[model samples]
Structure formats: C-alpha cells, structure tokens
Target chain A: MVSALGIQLGVVGAYLLVALAVGLLAYRLTSRDAEDYYLAGRSIGTVVLLFTTFATLLSAFTFFGGPDLAYRAGPEWILVMGVMDGVLFALLWYVVGYKQWLVGKAHGYVTLGEMLGDRFGSKRLRALVAGISLFWLFPYVMLQQMGAGEAIVGLTNGIVPYWAGAAGITVFMIAYVVIAGLRGVAWTDTLQGLFMLGVVWLAVGWVATAAGGPSALSNALATNKPEFLALGGGLYSPQFIISTAITIAFGVAMFPQINQRFFVAKSGAVLKRSFALWPVLVVLLFVPAFILGTWAAGLGISVPEGANVLPVLLNEYTPVWFAALVVAGAMAAMMSSSDSMLLSGSSYFTRDLYRPFVDASLSDAREAWIARIGVALFATLTFVASLFRPGTLIEVGDTAFGGFAQMALPVIIALYWARTTRSGMFAGIVGGQLFYLAHVFVPAFEIAGITVLGGTYLTWDFALWGMVLSALLTLGVSSLTAAAPEENQSRFSEGLRAD
Target chain B: MTRTSIDYLWIVTFAILVTFAVPWFLWGDSRVFAGLPLWLWWHIGWMVLAAVVFHLFTRRAWDRGIVEGGR
Candidate 1:
C-alpha cells in the first residue's frame, strides 16, 4: 500500500503546478510595463478585484490560524472574525477605498504612500508611511511563511522539515510574483480563492457528517464544552474581542496590499459591489470553519498541543485525497496572500523609498527592475525570519495588525482633514507608534494616579489606547499648526469630492 | 442625503452596534440557538443591519459629492 504521506504530497504537488501554470499564463498576457505589472493596468473588474483582496486578506491566518484559534479557544472567535470583520472591513472599504480609487485614478497613484505624501506635500511623510507600513507588514508576511512551514510538517507527519516547507513556498511565491505581477496575482488569486472556498466547504461537510452531523456536533459541544459555545469562552474576553475587531478593521484598511487594491478597481461601482458582497463571503467561509473546529472535540481527534489542528484534523478524519486537497488549499491561501504582499512591498520600496531618496529621475523600466529586486529581497528576509520561528502565527499577526491600526488615524485625517499639517500627521504616526511600543516593551509604571507604558484599560488591549492617543496627538497638533497652503487644500478637496 | 449626514449615521450606528449597542446587552446572556450562541446571532444580526445601512449609503450617497462634480 502506498504511504498516505505520498498521496498527500502528490495531490499538493499537482495543485501547486496548476498555480504555476496560471502564473505563466498571466506572464504571457501581461504587458512589460510598471502600470501593467503593478496595478494590472488599473483595469481589474468586480469579481477578480474582490476575490484577490479577499484571498490575500484571508491568508494562511484564515486557513490555519482561524481553525487553531477556534479549536483551542471556542466559537466566540468566529464572531470576532465572521460577524465583525464582515461588516467592519466592508464599511472601511467603502469609506476609504472609494476615495482612494478616485484620487489614484486621477493622479495615476499606485501606492498608499503616494496618496498620503502628495496630500500632505511632504516627501518625508511618504517615506515615514512606507517605513511604518514595512515594519508592520514584515511580520504578517512571516506569519504566512511560518503557517506554510507548520502545515507542511503536520501534513507530512514530519516527513519534511520546517525549513524545507518555508523555503519551498518562498521560492514558489517569488516565481509567481516575478512572473505575473498584479494581473497574475489577481487571476491566480481568483482561481485559488474559489478552489480554497470549495475545498474548505467540502472538508467541513465531510467532517461534520462523519462526526454525526451538525446537530450532533452542537449537542456534543453543549454537553461537554459549554464554554466553547458561549462568550468569554476559552481564550476570549469581552475586551479582547472588542479590541481585536477594532484593530483588525483599521489594520486591514492600512495594509499596503489591500490599500493598493483600491487603485486597481475598474470603477466605483465595481468597488461598491465588492465591498457589498464581502461580508457574505466572510460569513460563508468562517461559519463552517469555526463549526468544524468546534466539532473536532466531538470527533475526539487528537493533535499535538499547539500544533496546527486543521491539517491533523483532516489527515485523521478524511480520505487521503481530500486531506491533500485541503492542505493544498491552505498552501494556496499562503501563496495568494504572500504574492500580493511581496508585490506591494516592491511598490513601496521602488516608488516610495527608491524613487524619492535614491534616484528621482530613474526610468519607469528601471523602477520596475528595482521593484522586482525588492520583492526577492523582502521575501528572503521573511523566509529567514520564519526559520527562527519567532512566535505563534496569531501573536505575530496581532502585533502587525496593532501597528497598522495605530496608523489609521493619521491616514484618515490626512485624507479628509485639509487642516491636517504634515507635522501633525507625522507626529500622530510616530507618537502613536512610540506609545504603543512603550506599552508593549516598557514595564508598566503607575504613580500618583498615572499609568505609564501600560498595556490595557480595564480589560481592553493597548490598541484602543494607541488609537485614542494617536487621534488626540493628530487633532491637537493640527489645531496648533498652519494648515497646508490654500491651493493645496483646494486641490485636496477637488480630488476628494465625488465625481 | 447629505454626505456628513450619511457618514455620521454610519458612524453612530456602527458605534452603537459594535462597541456598546448590541454586544453589551448580549454578552451577559449565555443562551444557545441553532448551533450558535445568542450573542453570536446578535452580532450576525448587526452584520445584516450593517449590510442594509451600507447598501443605502452606497446607493444614495457614496459618490454624491465627487463622481459627477470632480472628475
């Protein structure tokens, strides 16, 4: 009899080959220019734009970490993402994305830093925005690599080492991004997104049925693990849920990869439709994944403590063929997310940092070359970090989310508040980051009714504090400073007003 | 609808629904329904309500000030 590992690897291998084929197809179709390469020539339609953003945002965290959290914590984690993320992310996409699209289209802007920098009339602000974005973005990219590595180790039953898994994805993702750019990323993301959604539902359906169906699974949890069904169950607290929801929504808004998608939309209607349908997609994916995770206890499937439960759950409970498909789907999630991130990182480096600081007069073709090189370097850095295995995927992901959340205030103010000076925006970004870092790194101190470098209020996390503090600094500084010149302010209004 | 009028409404509704409006009332209760907790259902209800609010905002006012005037 063939080893189960062999069958699983074969299935996953075949799936990845298809992904490569899709990338090569995109390469053939793509035009050799920055516009075509980075933003898909700014012509992405509703379905592709929606799925690419969805798949990239969902990532390995959604596939692997979501199940792990649900399995270990409880179903409340589901509501944290499913209900909250659906509404919050869609709302943000509507509010920020539409305006960004308008401005980006008018000016041919491609990166978030470009928008913020031009609005504030400060190149330093652009560099700062890119710097903060890269700082937060690296850990998220590393989380994908780490998740890929862990999934491989679990699926292969340690037939493969962790470094090999991490390196395999790193190399594959580099090839995918370098070949296809944004068009390829979007096309492949659409295909992989649908594949992941289909296989996930299939895995969940088979598992739930084999475990005696949904009602039986529910009954088992209700009887044995009541905490798993209720609020504040397992690892969830009220404050944690609230903080996480707020941070995730804002963090997503600022993600270079997600923000750049706003520029790729074909029209405002396409963007609107994408945001409108986003919550529905989240509901479909999250509801089943969380339910199956809860049902794992009912099935009495055992995984090593702190291991990724998704692969183990599949391998033990399903057919080898199905198990392989699910693993590949998870890998697809990682690749789809990583490619966009690698692509976005390249844009940040080339457009924001390289062009402004290194060579303002470089040809567009040379800029694209630098961008391609940037992608390889950024992916290499993350791959090396993943080998160290610094933290759990969720923890690292949350840190990145929190950093981006702190930037939301400055970004929003820069967009809408013409009075917002470059100094104020800069202060808001730096001050919030400084305070949040202090909160995270410095030991807590309290003296004379003052708490310094603290983490939480009542039970809420530091992100809330950081957001409030950042907003205050922005408002306070803006109130005291001279606004941008009248012409600049009018230009901003002209750009922001809906046409 | 005026821009701020709609924007502020979304802000208030989301604030009330997400931060204190719904979750506060549901958190204390521990009842389960249809394989999900009462609180979870409430959050889902908020999602539906939010979807409706978003649909209205996008239809009536999303591009009110920009699309026709600026471009």
Candidate 2:
C-alpha cells in the first residue's frame, strides 16, 4: 500500500507533469515572431483571455494570503479584496484597459514603456518607466517563489527543503516561458486557473462539512471571536478598508503582467466580456478562501503562522489525497503568476530597455531570443532572492502593490490627458517613488514629540499618499511644461475621443 | 460613440453600489444569519448586484469610441 506522504507527493508531481505537458503543447502551436511569442499574436479569445487574466491576477496572495488574513483579522478582508477590489478593478479594466487596447492596436506597441515612449517621443522616459516597473516587479515575482517554497515545505512537512521547492518552481517556469512565451503561459494559466478554482471550492466544502457545516462554523465564530462577525473595529477600520481597496485596485491596473494583458485580447468584444466577468470570478475564488480562513479561527484551529493556516487546516480536516490536491492548486496559483510575470518582465527588458537603449537596430528574431534569455536570468535571480525569505507574503506583496500604485496616475494621465509631457511623467514617477520609499525606509518623523510622516497616518496607508503625490506632480508639472507636439498627442487622443 | 443618458445612469449606479459596499452601516451589529454575520450577507447581496450591473453595462454601454474607432 502507498504511504500517505507518497500519495500526496504523487498528486503534486502528477500536477507538475501535466502543467509541463500543456506548456510543451503550446510551444508547438506558437510561431517564432516577437508578437506571437510575447502577446500570443494579440489573438486570444474571450475564454482564454478571461482565465489567463484571472489566473495571473489571483496569485498566492488569494490562495494563501486571503485565507491568512481572514484567519487573523476576520471576514472584513472580504470587504477589502472581494467586494471592493473585484468591482473596482473591473471598472478600471473598462476605463483604462479599453483605451490602452485601442492605442496599443494602433501603434503596435508591446510594452507600456513603448507606448508611453512613443507618445512623448522620449527614450529616456521609456527606460525610466521600464526601470521602475522592473524594480517593483522583482519583489512581486520573488513573492511567488517564496510562496511556492513555503507551500511545498508546508505540504511535505519539511521533506522538501525551502530552497529546493523554490528552485523547483523557478526551473519549471523558466523552462516553459523560454519554450513558448505568452502562448504557453496563457494556455497553462487557463488549466491552472481551472484547477485552482475547483480544488479551493472542494477544500472549502470538505472542511466545512467536517466542521459541521456553515451554521456550526458561524456559531463557533460567534462564541469565540464575535468581532469578526462585524466591521469597523481594530484592523477593519473604515479608513483601512477604503485605503486598501483603492491602493490595490489602482496597483493592479499598473501591474506589468496585468497591463500587458490589456493589449492581448483579440477584439473589443473579448475585452468587454472578460472585464464584465472578472468580478464574478474574483468573488468565486476569494469568498471561499476567506470564509474558510474565518471559520478556522472559530474552529480553534492552530497554525504556526498565518500563512500556514490553510495548509495546516487542510491536513487536519481533509483526506491526504485531497490535501495534496489543494496544495497543488496553491502551487498552480504561484506558478501561473510567476510565469506570467517572468514573461512580461522579459518583454519589458527586451523591447523597452535593451532594444531601444542598447541596440536600436536589433532584428525581431534576435529580440525574441534575447527576451527568452532575459526570462531565464530573471527567474534565476529571483529564485536566489527567494532563498532569503525577506518578509511575510502579505507584507512583501503589499509593498510591491504600493510601488506599482505610484505609476497608475502617470499612466492614466498619459492615456487621456493630451497635455501630459515626458518631463511631467518623469517627475511624477520619480517623485512618487522617492516619497513612498522615504515613508517605507525612514523612521517616523517627530518634531519635539509631534508625530509626522511614516506609518499609517490617521489610518490611511502610505500608498494612498503616494498616489496623491504622483497625481499632483503629474498634473502640476504637465501644466508648467510644454505639451508634446499636437500630432503626437493626437496619436492617442484622436482615436480615444468620443464622437 | 457618443455619451448617452444610459452611460450617466450606470456611472451613478456603480458609484452608489461601491459606496454602500463597505459595511459602515452595520457597525456594532453582530447579528448572524444562516451562520454568517449580517454584514457578510450584505456583501453577498451587494456583490451579486454589482455583477448584474456589470453585465448590464457591458450590454448597454461597454463600446465607446475605442471599439468603433479601432475597427
């Protein structure tokens, strides 16, 4: 008879093999052109686009962090991630993504830097945007690796060391990304997305039933921790909820992986349909994870740390095979996110940073090859960084989100506002980043015992302030600076203006 | 491509939905219904309403200048 550990490992191994097979199959279908490799030839249909975007956006954060937060803080996490960001991000998809698709289609742009650079006629600005995106993206990519490591270690009870687990995913993702690029990433994302959804719901049902269903779970919570049943107390303050919601929504809009997706849908109809369904998909995944986490608290389940709550709870309540399947689902979430980030990061380096700055005359085939190399190097570097285990998954993820949130103002201004100049964009991007860093790195300011900047001021997160500063700089600087040439402005504005 | 009354209506509708999504109104109320808090039930209904609004928006107003202009 097979041992429980063997069965668990077998399920995870089988999942990885299937993922690799899917990636290789996509490699066969992919063409050699840069566009085809990077953006799937901009021909992704509604279903693939929806699932890929869904999978790419909902990472270890949703699978692990969401449950962890609910376990500690309560169900108010549902307010922050589920109800608020779900609808808000979908709105942004329409407000910002639609316009981006139009502009990208018209210009044949592949990266955000390329689009912004062309609009303002500034190569330096393009490089700046690429640099900042890469800087923030690095931590987020490492977040996935760290999550994979911890998750694998959690499932195997230390049989698989953290470094090996991180390395395993990094190697697998790099192999597939280099093999088929966005085509493989998207196809695999669809499969992994489906796998994650099904497994998470199953885990929720099994655990809930074992705990005597939702009513019993709620009774447990009501008796043990009643604050979780209400709102506006402790960590679930009104300001905390609103600020987190805004920051995450805007930050998601600027994620390089997600932003690149705006240009990948085959038609406007596909884009519309995808955004329309995004909120519902988000709800379906987030609610179950958060509810389970909240229920864990009531059930008096103990975990080493918040991040370990889901895995520990599953082991205690569910069957061994089911636990392994859920762990694989969590791995699916991590790999789906990491692969997309690596693929998009490569596009940024090759198209925006290297080609324009290093070798302006590089051939398309050579550029594609360079991007593959970049993915390998990038994945390897982040894998090594993941070994350090810098911060908790939520802390590291929040920092990256805030960093990217600084870019949203400049992007929106560049897209809709005609007067947006290259210098203004630079000032906003750099100034906001510096200020945010000051808040992050510097100790709280005090003048003779009076508190100032650093940490949440009056309950608002530093990210909200960073975004406000970014917008002010962008608008203030653009007003004083000369506008880009009217013809250049018209490239975006002419097509986007309502008739 | 032109802005319509329907577009304005959706903008207002979504704005209201977002405003009420936060359970400030339910502060200090710990009533549990069906083994869940009243606030949780509020969010469940709110999300369902939001999804419906989104579907309606896509049918009625999703295509603006971008779609037609791209084609």
Candidate 3:
C-alpha cells in the first residue's frame, strides 16, 4: 500500500497533464467574450456535445456507487437503477428536451434562469431562479470536490493525505477553468471520459478472471447473498425502491445545469441521440460494476456502513495498477460532474447576479472575467462546505434534488401555467423549499416523537410527497392571486410552444 | 374515438415495456434464463422487457431526428 502511493502520484499526474492539454487546446479557439466563456458561443457540434454530455452525466455516483450498491445489495439494485437511468434519459429525449432545445435556440437562452426570465417576462423571477439553482447545486459541486479528495486518498492509501489531494485537485481545476472555460471543460471531459470507460471495462475483465471466471463468481455470490440474487425481493424495501426510481427519474428534470446542457445541443435530433446512448452506458458500464459488487459480497467485505461494498472489495481483489485506474476513474467521474456544475452554478452568480444586477454596464470581456472569478469563489466555498460531509450520499442527493423540485414550480408556472404571478411563483418556491428542508432537518431537532411541524423528512420514499406539495403550493398560490400580466403570459406561451 | 390521452396511455404502456421493462426481464438470469427462482426471473424479465424496447425506441427516435441547424 505504501509503494502504491508512488503509482497514485504518477497516474493522477498523467491524467492531469492530459486534461490540461485538452484545456490548452480549447483556450486556443476562444476570444474575450462572455458568450464564448460561458456557452462555447452556443455552437458546440453534435459529437462533442454528445460525448461531453455522456461524460458529464456519469459522476462518482454512477461509476463507484453502482458497484458499491451491487456489491452490497445485489443484482436487483443494478437492474432497477440501470434501467431507470436509461429510462430517465429517454424521457428527457422524447418528452421535454427537444422542445427546450428549440426554445433555447430561438431565444439565446444560456441558463435556466434566462429561460425562465424570457418565459415569464420577469427579471426578478429569473434572479430568484438563478438564486435557487445556485443554492441547489452547491452541495452537488462540493460532493465532486469531496470525491476528488476521497479518490486520491483511496488511490494512494494515505500517502498523499486527503487534504493535500483535495487541495491539489482544486488548484488544478481552477487553472483549467481559468484557461479555457466551458470549451476546456468539455474537451478534457471527452478525453477523460473515454479513458475512464476503457479503465472500467478492463477492470471488470480482470476482476472476473481473478474470481475464477464469471460463472463461478456468480455461483459464489448467490450462495452468500442469495437475497441479491433474488432480483426482485430482498433487494430494497418497497418504499426505498419507489423512492429510488422516482427520485432519479423526475429529479433529473429539475437540474438547471443539465437544463443548460440542452442549449449546447445543435438540434432536437442530437437530443434524441444523446438519450439513446444513455441506456448503453448503463448496460455496458454500470452492469459490470454491479457484477463486481456481487463478487465482493461473496468475500464478506465491509465498507463504510452507509457506503456500498466496492471499496472494501476493490482493496481486497484488484491489482495495484487496476486500483490506480479505478481510483482515476472515480476521480474522473467527480471532476466531470463538478467542473460542469461549478461552471454553471457560477454562471448564475455572474450572469444573473453580477452582470445583470450588480454591474449592468460591464463589457463582454469584463463579464467573462467575472465568470472566471465566480468559478474560483464557488469552488472555494464548495470545498469548504464539503468538510461537513452531509449524512449519506443519498441524503445530500435528496436535498439537492428537492431544491430543484422547489424551483420546478416556477419553471412549470412560467412555461405552461399562465395564471401564475411572480408573487405566487416566488411564494410557492419559498413555501416548497422551506417545507422540504423542514422535513429533512426538523426531525433531528425534534423533541420526543413530535416533528417540528409534526412532519417527517419524507425520508427515503417521501421525496415524491415533497415534490407534490411544492407543485400544489405553486398552483394554489397562483390561482388565488391575480392573473399574470398579459405580456408575460404571451411570452411564456410563445416560449413554451403550447400549441 | 381518437383519444390522444388514451393513445398516449397505450404509447406509455409500450413505452414502459420498451423503456424499462423488457431488458430487465430478459437479462435477470444466467445465460438466457437458466437456473433461477420463478419470481426472480419474473422480476428480471420485467426489467429487461421494459429496458430493451426502451433502448430500441430511443435509438429509433435519435435516428429519426435532425440535430443540426442553419440549413
């Protein structure tokens, strides 16, 4: 393990060098403008867009957590989670994404806030949304940085130290962000993604071989964790299953950063193509992780109680070189998710907050610089916030996911529901977000059996209940208020294309 | 009676099959349905059946769309 530290520095250094080269290449193509800095001037081609989106979407959760869950739970979790991811993207393709892409193109909408602003004829609401988006996304961004640190430590096994690894990764990230902005992030993401994907396949093959081949491993796993083998039952309580499925499915719809990615798509067709690739990733990549998980279970390996089983299993089974690759892959996933998110979240801060509200007279070049500055600040805060790692990854997931659902009220109200007032939308958002947080945090502070408002955190399964309350609040508030101003309704309908 | 919602319902059901149901069913066992409990196979069957059709439909839709602009 001590010697493995040498490999860690070498591999991580190599990957960082490759990543920086991609950033430098991207920097060569841009000029000093906010548009270029933020959205690649809204002109990314289909292939780069597709690959980058693919790379961006598969974070540490999918890469590491999939195997972890599988190792702990069984085949059923993998089957459901994998299928749900594909299903989620497909729905994104068919139902909402294309239309959003079209509307975004028509209006030069770069951020979800911009989309809401245009749709609602209310800059204040846009700012509100921008605020919500930033708040919702911060923890997610922090998690990525946190993962980068964790992967470094895991990959090195305390040789590098978690703090040093985290700080080193963050410094590298800031340098990348300053050099190329979105272009650099997207380009490096593509190369990193391909590298990580290759590493996953090789690791799977190697592990399968070491375990006396796939058949024997499967047989062994079944004897040990027959519940996992059961597929349907013994996998998860029914409530957790529904929660898992719904949270992933609808929860995806609310992410503003993902929403922003839609605009970079060249057309609706690319949107569909992207969705098509989503399932294949699950089958090819995630399934193997789950299989690895199954293999780990047979060994009776222990992990962080809340963590899935792969870390312990990986430590036990895989070769050092492969471990480095797995570490690199996990780190890559974190970098991919965080870089894009940090960039987007900071866009809201700079674009909606500073550019429009703080300094309307700023030049395009100045705007670009401010955006770069925002990235630095956001990263620093996210890194700091991560020191207080929230409960389980799932709890953090719910908070972020629920935050977006709170904004879903404004999104739907602005686009489809015309009767919504800014006051109503704003009120609904506040009510929903507060209610969700209360449900999440209040129980811990509760005295005896009574919750603060006599409500629950909507724990694993009750996320849907939170979403429903948010939507209902938005709708009810809007109805009780006066109709939205006439022009806002027109712009919203036009933007929504509610023919 | 031409009902869009009803049409959508059928579409959704087919969607459920293609999107998340089929692949789950077909792939849940060892090498094309060997040696697994009856209920286990049923669960896998549902997942594969839903998932495979979903994959095909997704690809088909992607193949059908024109992703570029400024023609």
The number of the candidate with the highest lDDT is: 2
Task: Give the per-residue lDDT of model 2 (tens digit) for B1-71.
Answer: 34556556767887887888766788878888878888877887787778888888777666543455322
Q: For residues A159-212, could you state the per-residue lDDT of candidate 3 as single tens digits?
A: 565566667667777777776564466666667777777876777677777777
What is the lDDT ranking, best to worst?
2, 1, 3
Considering every candidate listed, which one attains the maximal DockQ? 2
User: Which structure is stronger by lDDT: 2 or 3?
Assistant: 2
True contacts kept of 3: 0.09
> Model 2: how many Å of interface RMSD?
2.6
Clashing pairs in model 1?
Answer: A497-B66, A498-B65, A498-B66, A498-B67, A499-B66, A499-B67, A499-B68
lDDT (Cα, tens digit) per residue for candidate 2, span A1-499: 2487798779887887777777777666654433464644677778878887888656876677777788888988888886446788888898788888878887788788888888888888889888989989988888888877777766766666778778878887776776555446777777788888888898888998998988999888988987888776768777888888888888888888889888877788898778767767877888887888888899898775323578768888998888888877678667867888877887888878998779989997888788788878888888888888878777788888888889998889878788887778888999999988888777887988766666676668888988999999999998999875532777677654321
Which stretches of model 2 miss by more than 4 angstroms? A29-40, A179-182, A305-307, A484-487, A496-499, B1-8, B64-71
Ranking under DockQ, best-scoring first? 2, 1, 3
Which stretches of candidate 1 lie above 4 Å from their native place?
A30-40, A181-183, A443-454, A484-487, A495-499, B1-11, B14-24, B28-30, B41-46, B64-71
| Per-model B-chain TM-score | 0.61, 0.75, 0.37
Native contacts retained by candidate 1 = 0.33
Estimate, for each residue in A456-486, the C-alpha lDDT of model 1 and write its tens digit: 7767788888998899899889889886662
Q: What is the lDDT of residue A7 in candidate 2?
A: 88
Off by over 4 Å in 3: A29-40, A232-235, A302-312, A444-460, A495-499, B1-11, B18-71
DockQ of each candidate relative to the true complex: 0.40, 0.53, 0.19
Q: What TM-score, over all chains together, does every model reach?
A: 0.92, 0.93, 0.85
Ten residues in sequence with the least summed lDDT for candidate 1 chain A: A486-495
